[model samples]
Target: MLLLALLMGGLQEAGARPNPQALSARIEVREHTARAILFELRVRNDSGHRLTLALGGRPAYNVLVKRPDGTLIWEWQRGQIVQQILEYRSLDPGEELHFEATWKLVDARGRRVPAGEYLVHGVLNLEPPETLVTDSLRVRVAPAKRRRSAK
Candidate 1:
C-alpha cells in the first residue's frame, strides 16, 4: 500500500501546472507627443531551458486601450490580417521578445479622444502548453493646443 501511494503522488506532481515564474509579460508606455502615445509589449523567458511558443493564426500579442471607467476605446487586432499558418519561435533562457504600436489619440472611429488618464492592457498568448500572460500600464494624454488666428 505504501508503494502504491507513493507512485500516485509522483504522478500527480508530474501533471501539475508549470511554475508561474517560468514566463513573464510586461507593458511599457511613453508619450510620443501631445497627441501620440507609444506602447511596447515584452515577453521574457525565465526558465533555464529554451522555451518554444506557438501563436496560432492570430497576432502573437494584443493591446487594448480603455478609459478609467472600463470603456473599451481601441484594440490592436481590430483590423489586422493574420495568415492562417501556425507561427512558432524559440526563446533562450533570460531572452526577451517585443512588439510595439503607436496610438494617435484617436478612437476606433477615427475621432480624436479627450485628454485624460487611460489604461493600456497587453497580452502575450503562447500555445503548446496554452498559457496567457498579461500586464497593464497607465498613460496620460494631453489635450492638443489650438493655434490662434493671425491678425
Candidate 2:
C-alpha cells in the first residue's frame, strides 16, 4: 500500500511542474518577505566534462540580460566572461553551479514596471564561431487588491 501511494504522489508531482530540461537553462525564483524577487541561474552540464557557455556572432558576444524586444539591459565585460570561463571550466560529472542576476522592478529606461507579465532572459553573443545560448523566463507582478469602497 505504501509503495502504491508513493508512486501516485510522484506522478502527481511530476505533472505539477515544468520539465527543467525542456529549456536551455533553469532558474529558481524566490520571493522574499520584503517582496524582492531573486533570479538564480543554473546551467546543466550533462557530460560533466569541460563545458563552455560559449557565445557566437559579431562583436564577440558577451553575457547579457536583455529586454524581451532585444534591447540590452545589462552587459558583462569580456574580462568578466573570461573570468567565468576560468572559474567554471571542466565541470565535474553531475555537478551544477548557480549564479544570480538581479533586476529591479523597472525597465532598462528606468520606468516603473506595470502590473503585468514580462520575460527575463539571458543572451550570450559575440563574433563567429562562438555558439549562442538563449534562455528565457516569465515573471509576473500583480498589485495588491484594493479594498472595496463602503457605500
Candidate 3:
C-alpha cells in the first residue's frame, strides 16, 4: 500500500521536502460495506502561521473516483450545488479539517459500477494563492452476494 501510495504521489514520509502550502493532506478508504464505500479526506495546518482558506461557497475539498484503467467514474463536485459567495475559514497551526462521504457504488450517470479496484482521490482547493493539495488511495469493491429464494 505504501508503494502504491508513493507511485500515486500520495504519501509523504517525514523529513521530505517541505510542502510549499505548509499543509498535510491524505485520503483514506475508511470502510467498504455491501452497499457503499466510505472515504475520508483530511487536511492539517502544519505551519507556524494561521492559514486562511477561501472555498468560494463550494466544498473545501473534492473527492473523485477512477477505474484502474484511468477512466473517471465519479466526482463529488459534479453534482454539488453551491451559492456564489466566497467562504473563508482560518485554521490555526496544528488544526485539522476533515471531509467524509459515502459512494453508493454508482458511476457519474447513476448506473451501478462494476466490482473492481478503483482509485479514490481527494483534493483540497484553496484560493488567494491558488494552491491545490492532493492525496489518493485504492479500494476494491467486491461482487454482491446472491440472495436465496424461499424454499
The TM-scores of all predictions, comma-separated, are: 0.78, 0.50, 0.76
Decoy 3 TM-score against native? 0.76
lDDT tens digits, residue span 72-141, model 2: 5544343243422211133453555455655555555655555655555544332222233445566676
Weakest lDDT window of 10 consecutive positions for candidate 3:
1-10
lDDT of each: 0.67, 0.42, 0.67
The CA lDDT at 94 in model 3 is 80
| Model 2 per-residue lDDT at 114 | 57
After superposing candidate 2, which stretches have Cα over 4 Å from the reference? 1-24, 32-35, 48-88, 124-134, 144-151
Report the Cα lDDT for candidate 1: 0.67
- Estimate the Cα RMSD of every predicted model relative to the unseen true structure: 8.7, 13.6, 7.6
Deviation (Å) of 105 in candidate 1 = 0.9
Candidate 2 residue 104 C-alpha distance from true site, Å: 1.2
Candidate 1 lDDT over residue span 1-151, tens digit each: 0000000012224344455466677778744777778888877777677756555555667788999998999987778886655566777878887888788888889788888988888765544335354645778888878889899
Over the stretch 1-151, how does candidate 3's per-residue lDDT look in tens digits?
Answer: 1101110112232223334546677888788798898888877776677655455445666788999887889988787875555556677878877888788888999987888889888866554234344655888888877899899
**Candidate number with the higher lDDT (2 or 3):** 3
Evaluation by TM-score, superior candidate among 1 and 2:
1
